[model samples]
Target: MPHTKDELPDVLYSAAQVRALDASLIAAGTAGFELMQRAARATWRALVRQWPTANELSVLVGHGNNAGDGYLVAVLAQRAGWSVRVLAVGDPQRLQGDAASAHAEAVSEQVLIEPWTAQSGLRGIVLDALLGTGLSGDVRDPYVSAIAAINASGLPVAAVDIPSGLCADTGRILGDAVHADLTVTFIGLKVGLFTGDAADVTGELVFNDLQADPQLLNGTAFTARRLCIANLPRLVSRAPASHKGKFGHVLLIGGDRGYGGAILLSAQSALRSGAGMVSLSTRPEHVSPALSRIPEAMVLGTSSANQLMGLLEKVSVLVVGPGLGQAGWGRSLLSTAANAPLPQVWDADALNLLAGGQVDLPKGCVITPHPGEAARLLGVSTADVQSDRPAAAHALSKKYTAVVVLKGAGSLIAHPDGRLALCHQGHPAMATAGLGDVLAGLLGALLAQGMEPFDAACLAVWLHANAGEQQGKLGRGLAASDLIPAIRQLLEEQAPCLK
Candidate 1:
């Protein structure tokens, strides 16, 4: 499994799509106020489950339905005999629709409500209900100060819907966002929660649909699909008569001078990931060590583009990157790969060379770029790419007309046809060198086996992330070579060769 989603849905939506789904539910005879109440109850249940011993609740409310949720949660807290108070950041009188009704209900329950000030104190578990998906621009005014106070309070915080000041579409933090210990979301999962800056602020995510009917959600459009076992690309089972030539051959080219280990890591990963015949083309000096490391692979000491001619003719797929520097050797090799019409996986120095405008990327290519390389390729700052990763991935795919794998905390795979998939499983300890090299090779092997470009990228990303997660449990000091064996085991578990 990519991620252990017990009951969490795979579909991810922009805030607008989720709102449209909510509207459709309302149109199908569910009242808007009733949905608000269900959301409040779900939040209340999650809050209590998160911190049952906390006998006090401090809820921050704004002028929208998010405030309605907070007000109703305050009612639940007060009736349960817990000390509860509402810090009305947005004036309660300005609340409209179901929010106004919730305010009246809180007033009737005698819940202590007061205007928020810089000096206001928050005790017990804090509920961030200041803003939901309605936020578009940066956070303003007293709300910023209120959010800072909540973060500084050092209490267990539960955010209703989403944290205030975080963009629901891009996951970009607007000014500042509440760092909640738990966040209980409603209806559908937002794309913001899985990518961009969401991982830094969203902790312990809990999804509640507010009990919306499945019939009402069938036809709703989604922004992206999360990769999981059910939807991952499947490898066909091997027959008893299967031979070495059954799977396609892969040619991996890299390793200029000082960087020899990166290409070997990739070659070993490709061999382990089931490439029929893995060929390594590297510096003449690396030949002995490469042969010693991975004897199962055919190691070639390639110093110039002429050295790769015969091998390139036989190989069906090429992985052109990883340790390939900006020198003439790397440039010549990458240029030759660019001219080949075969499927290719470009990564590391290959991506850098493409960004340098030296060579045009070939068709049937999958380019794996981290934020920095993506920014260089897109001619934007790294901050701009990270600010909206999904958009950057889409733009890169459209520009190069190749399947793009934007690698980061949450890796995105975007196709030229507008299909987007996301990989949400990864570990901080997996942030080591040569990991991208391994990913490039894994993607190459999948492509060599005849998976579609988008599907191969999605499956490779999921396997690489999950393997890193499995190995990262030992804490730090995780080496890049450690992922190869783990990836091999996971691939077997996911798509067994013997069926």
Candidate 2:
């Protein structure tokens, strides 16, 4: 059956961890074949639920337990009077153990089986049970051709365990991975299913533990926690006599000559997201517009580091680099903010300047970088950062000694000590400009309000993405400012004021 986001398990595991979990279950009395059969049953159930009218199925089977599951699914389809055929990519003669038994069961059930070939015609809904988690390198030969054909086919496809050719550990596409409309993963939710290229390949994800032992499942260690509103760090409510000063002030620095909008968005977002007092330090020319746009913000126009130092004395948190250019004016302001002892959130040009070695990341700060900026910070190509985001995030966190929020499709929040969290919600509309500026401001607001760096980053990310998701439903043209009010409402709902 189709599962809701909240219904899926929170803990994500590596391929090896999942295999160990499987082994633990097998060693504790459940036969490996029995587990395979359960997986097939679960996949069959989910497939039927997703497309009940698609009576005909073309099952692509390979070797290993994933293929065994496919063969059994074919058997179930045949027995249920649905037109079904199994195209074995791996030699049926080479099938071993439980997989061999499963193939024999399909044969005994009179299921049609044929060898996979480039010329082979595919009909009905395709089942991509090829190349399980065991595959480590790039997809080679006939399998690559088959995957290409399956993708070339417009037919709806369901992948077993994980999508073929998609790395179950890193979510990197090995050569080319099968883009499944529905992926039925079992035992544990693989980390790859939610990050990197997983979003491009894994369409509707369905997870079934196959009734794994709760004691064993709970005991299994996870690579990272998937951040959701239900599991997010909670914020305490305010007292009845509380004043604006109780929430703490957030000072946002950056708005060079032509980039006033970036800093304005950040300041407005900080105010809306619960910062007690939000201050904007920008170019002198921007003072009137800044106040006109966000009257609640305390606008301070300063082009020099000395002027910024005075403002720094009164703020609790610093959010730098929204419209911060690498020019002399931006550099001076950033230089002053960098030496401040306050907690900080750095983004955009601040990251660029940090990458250029002009300034060092302050301790107890949160740095938000998209792939491009991350590449600069890490001294690698953007492809390298995208290829393995978790590693990049961890490296950045350790290198800077700050919480790192690697913002992308599956946004990852990494702590300096190695703990990591991934945000699974974000909309295409969030790809607009000024969003990162808004995110930096939100991060600063959370930090000023007394959330830990890592916790603030995680909660801020969830709020930013979820608000984008909410506002994005209106369809396209989602402004960065459009997210602020929605975020304010959602934040209050998540961490209510009267509690």
Candidate 3:
């Protein structure tokens, strides 16, 4: 069984992919029954370690291999002198292969097996073995009722494999899923466990590899990588004789009349993140205020696309849509930026405008969209984007021919070349507005500092989330501007420059 602290292998498989892997392993000489036994033993060990004092177990067994795992768990508990009762939701006679063997073993061990009932007195540590990862559509009948009863039982639940009803590929709950206190997943870690609603439902996750053949496991394809500090690109120091001109200039365009703060935030973050020269093209009314707020940035007042064109020549990176309103001025500025050949980072109104088919993206651009923005860009409903974020991100990347950063609970960074990474590190307090703008600026800074678009985005996401987490510890009302210094501090801490 793989422990939580163990380095996650490169391969991350979805439920369907893992099923195919299981079949391959079986075809390659491993018996199907033996694999099932390994799953049960791995689950049992995780259960005992998590709840050592629990002497009784209520196993909710369903119709498939998930039920087989539950039956084997019941037999193991019974042998250990722990009271075990299996509430079978499906007919035991219909069970086939390894599932039938498990049922037979449970029956022979004197483990009580009874049909699921509403008032089954399901006490003690509940083991949810109902649906597993194969479930699609809505959850049906007895399993739904059984899951509800288990939740209401006030007992800590250990879910075998995945919590029943979770889409192993998307992390979306199909109708309803078991709310496990700890889920012991076997064979491989499912992508669903880390994203979408799975984070809430699958608490205290534990992975068990079942001691599968290393060669087979290594050969499987991964869906996405889990983002962490360790996986982030290494930050490089400036050369001893390097000057300000050595780093690229970053041009930030946005901040319509009432939204000046958004662009200012982006520009400030870019400056803090190491852009050589940070410039802001915003509403004429806010120019003086923006300059006063961050004198290091050259704030320009622009009312037309022509004004923006003059500044584009010197910029290496362009960050658009911070506080960009959907007005004529915002649209004109966006059109101007879209025509530029420089690398770009698009956020907020830029994404909304793109969704409306008003502007074409520049080549080598990065679009940072929250779910709503992502949904708009993809021509799908927000529900669709949230339902399967990884797929949505990939779709966005492929459609725009740009690096896509789908921002939400489990933020995803997708490249056009089929590389996808998931960042599971931010806090709930990060649910504030303007943070996405800050991220765009950070990306621009990294680009200005000469990182490739993909690496710049990956590192920026980690740095932005780390800053949010650090500021979030200071309590609520974490203004977007507060993350600026924190990001600068974190970057220096991660990669300090010599004086």
For residues 1-499, write the lDDT of model 2, one tens digit per residue: 1224567877888899999999999999999999999999999999999998989999998887889999999999888889998999999998999999999999999999999999888999999998999888999988999999999999999999999999988889999999899999999988888888888898889989988989899988888999876789967999999999989899999989788999999999999888899998999999999989899999988868888777888999999999989999988888888899999999999999999999988888899999999999999999999888888999999999989999988899999888989887877777799999889989988888889989999999999989998898787899999999999999999999876
Q: Is candidate 1 or candidate 2 better by lDDT?
A: 1
Error of 3 at 129 (Å): 0.7
Candidate 2 has an lDDT of 0.90
| Candidate ranking (lDDT, best to worst) | 1, 2, 3
Between candidates 1 and 3, the TM-score winner = 1
Pull out the clashing pairs in model 3: none
lDDT values, one for every candidate:
0.91, 0.90, 0.87
Residue-level lDDT tens digits of model 3 in 1-499: 1123435553467888889888988999889888888889888888899998989999998889999999998988888899888999888988999999999988888899999888788878899998878887889888788878887888999999999888899989888888889898888878888778877788777776777888887777878887765667856887789888978899999999889899999999999999989999998999889878899989889988898777899888999999999999999999988988899999999989998999998778999998998888888899999899899999999999999988877688999999998776666677798898899999999998889998898889988987988788787898998889999998898777554
- Give the lowest summed-lDDT range of ten residues in model 3: 1-10
Query: What is the per-residue lDDT of model 1 for residues 1-499, given as tens digits with 9 covering 90 to 100?
Result: 1223446788899999999999998998889999999999999998888787889999999999999999999999999999999999998889999999999999999999999998889999999999999798899988988999999999988899998988888888988999987889999999888888887888888999988888777788899998887889888888989887978899999999999999999999999999888999999999999999999999999978998888888999999989999999999999999988899999999999999998999987999999999999999999999999899999999999999999997789999999999888888899889899999999999988889899899999999999998899898999988999999999999989995
- Candidate 1 lDDT at 121 equals 90
